[model samples]
Target: MSAVLAQAPAAEAVEDLAASLQEAGTVAAPPEDADAAIEEIGLREKESDQVIDKSDKKDPLYAISITSFEDPALELGELILKGLYEMKFSRPSKIQAASLPKIKMGRNLLAQAHNGTGKTCCFVLGMLRIVTPDTTPQALCICPTRELAKQIEEEVLKMGKYLILHKGIKVKCILRDERWERGERITEQIVIGTPGKIVSLLNMKVLDGGSIRMFVLDEADEMLNLGGLGDQSKRIRQRLRKDVQTLFFSATYTDAVKRLATQLSMDNPWSQIEVKREHIFNDQVAQYFYRTNGVTEKLERLTEILSVVNVGQCIIFVHLRDTVEQLANTLTANGHPVSPLHGRMEAGARDKVLVDFRNGTTRFLVTTNVLSRGIDVPAVTLVINYDMPVRKGGTADPDTYLHRVGRTGRFGRKGSALNMIHDEKEMVVLKQIEAYFDRQGLIKEIPPDTDGEEFEKILNVQ
Candidate 1:
């Protein structure tokens, strides 16, 4: 039967070729062969040209040539120029370059860029241009988390150090736990704080909205995700005048966030910008993965990693508060310097942990996603995902995965991300993540006793 099948295929092929030659009045080729002949004669050359032109026109910057900081069109006050020089900002990032010009024109802006691309500076600079020393809360910047609010305040202060805004124009941080006094009006030119705090102050008539000429929302997507919509953001907006120039900035924007931003800005034409790089993973980061089961295996693998990797500063991400404390204790007992941070911790305790980490007193900080977004530590060289984040259908989003890895890489420095997955189900998720990033399998099995000098040599660990 196999011989007959093979011989029948040859006979059929001969008949088919003869039939093709007779039909064409010449030797006819397959459909694909005809297509190749047409293409070889340049029949589709005009179509290829049209495709190239379409692509070029679709590019965001096709007609827009970004101006350098020294461009004649770029204008700045003397105080602002001094502040920029003091902050040591030599050049503007892509977002900064694109948005600053429009912002200087006092246009409402909605911008999207990757983390660490300097979106914070773009809005800050824009606010500085609009805010005067006598202006009362002329610019208001709201962030999702208190940590982010505090960080933004610090950056604003640093960038405006040479200016007299700190003394002439007050900048207050409205924390959630703090209550607004009766006469404690927002007399500052710039106010930076969390949405909850700002909303509370506006509700209590402590934050005057009449003078708010410019509004900035940092991490706009996160603020909406945290449920900062309802009365707080709405009431705050109600107090602002109709002419207020609004700006929304975020690392990533979902459909919901975009809708919220559009409503806030009265459907202004938003500007979208992105900085393309070859790889999202930082080159300075030396990424590695290990397979482990349960808490004991996790601790063992972490111990092995810390013992070998020369990590000057590290952040360990955990899914739960209990795991954070437990890992901190275990690492401390194992002679590793570590600290714990979580949402459940008191505000003072969290502040102290951050201070210690910044001062080099704490070498390792284990926390949840609270430190993932706005917390910036330039020295963080190692980031370890001790436990995979629980997601819908036992799967996590790729954006969340990227944010977790983003903590370590900052200010053009190298960073590493180490993921731990033990079971086949988790391995399946890991494979999906690899496919999302267009990468091959990232998870590897570390053999037992893989901690010797030979292992170090294999990994090129010094």
Candidate 2:
């Protein structure tokens, strides 16, 4: 394992670094154009991020601001720009413009921003730019779930279309139950997979790490703090070349996970763009709650809400896989065609479900927190928390709540989040989340027995 991963503790290291930087009087400054750029992009004021660059600068990026993908500072290739235009991305998003340049500078980075902020493109473009047209893997990205891994691979293929066709660059998505020849080596130029699978491949000599120049961890906080994943991720990084440019991107991070991220940077002079609690909530998402008597009543209310409210796409969050199954059957019997997604489902089934949902074949998706973090679907206009999110110790998981609500209101689109509160525990969780965001009355309760018309009016649905 790498020394940083196995080091005593990161608390002291982070504190020491803070003290040294304070004494040296070198603190991070907000980019002059960041606020103006946010306004230009129509990003909500709460969505702005603060960047901290302690990297050994080849060139300073704080003073640098990119207006478009064609900016000289970004140095995006002609083919890549073509791909961007084909994808309908006319200009750089807030996160993309800010982080792409630092990535181009080849500095190790830890970036935090809200969901739907285009963090995927920042690292995908970086990998696509750095990777040579080769037979061996040149870039590796590890995500927490198979769904997220597949999503990243799709982006790679979409952005690297020209590279794949003209330059013969290949991309691969590695997941469980995907077979590899007994002694064959991975020939893909870019590999994206889960931590355990990637670690296993590295140990078995199936995936070569010597040529990997850029490493990325999406939903990095979960990658570093979840059970067994932290160690597995470390082992994979330990096997990579010492000079690899590492990047960690997540919507939220605990203090402990933030320290772990700093340690993972190793000897590299790292940079970070972190988002505070105040910056995670989207003003475009109107939040509301419904009080029910019990689980049965919660189910009744959810079905009632779906019957009347007109939603383009919706996600219903539950707490357990059994709930997913139960609700899927119940809702279907109640005349709603809903899709359920969870870790226990087969990979093929999950993929088909997500594809159907994204393409408008399915209008409602019921699942746990698996799709809460990095999955983005712009058409989703409503999110129903059938069961309020709670940590294992029965505390409110405010971060998860933020991510779940973030699924809607994506990219400045108007959306709504309706929380179903039944018991005292659920109410407590809701209150804690409200306090976490420091907005005591932000989440208002729907009028008792609100009709579908009244619901639409309150949420300002178009």
Scored by TM-score, the top model is: 2
Q: What does candidate 2 score on TM?
A: 0.87
- 138 in model 2: Cα distance from truth in Å? 0.7
lDDT of 2 by residue, 34-100 (tens): 4454433334434245444434344344424355677644557877877755655555666675677
C-alpha TM-scores of all predictions: 0.79, 0.87
Candidate 1: segments with Cα more than 4 A from true spot: 1-65, 165-167, 226-235, 275-286, 436-449, 452-462
Residue 48 displacement (Å), model 1? 24
Model 2 residue pairs with clashes: none
Candidate 1, residues 314-383: lDDT per residue as tens digits? 8888888998998899998998878999989988888889989988888899998788776788778778
Q: What is the C-alpha RMSD of each candidate to the true structure, in Å?
A: 19.0, 6.9
Please give the CA lDDT of all the candidate structures.
0.64, 0.79
Model 2 alpha-carbon miss at residue 298, Å = 1.4
lDDT of 1: 0.64
Provide the lDDT at 134 for model 1.
76
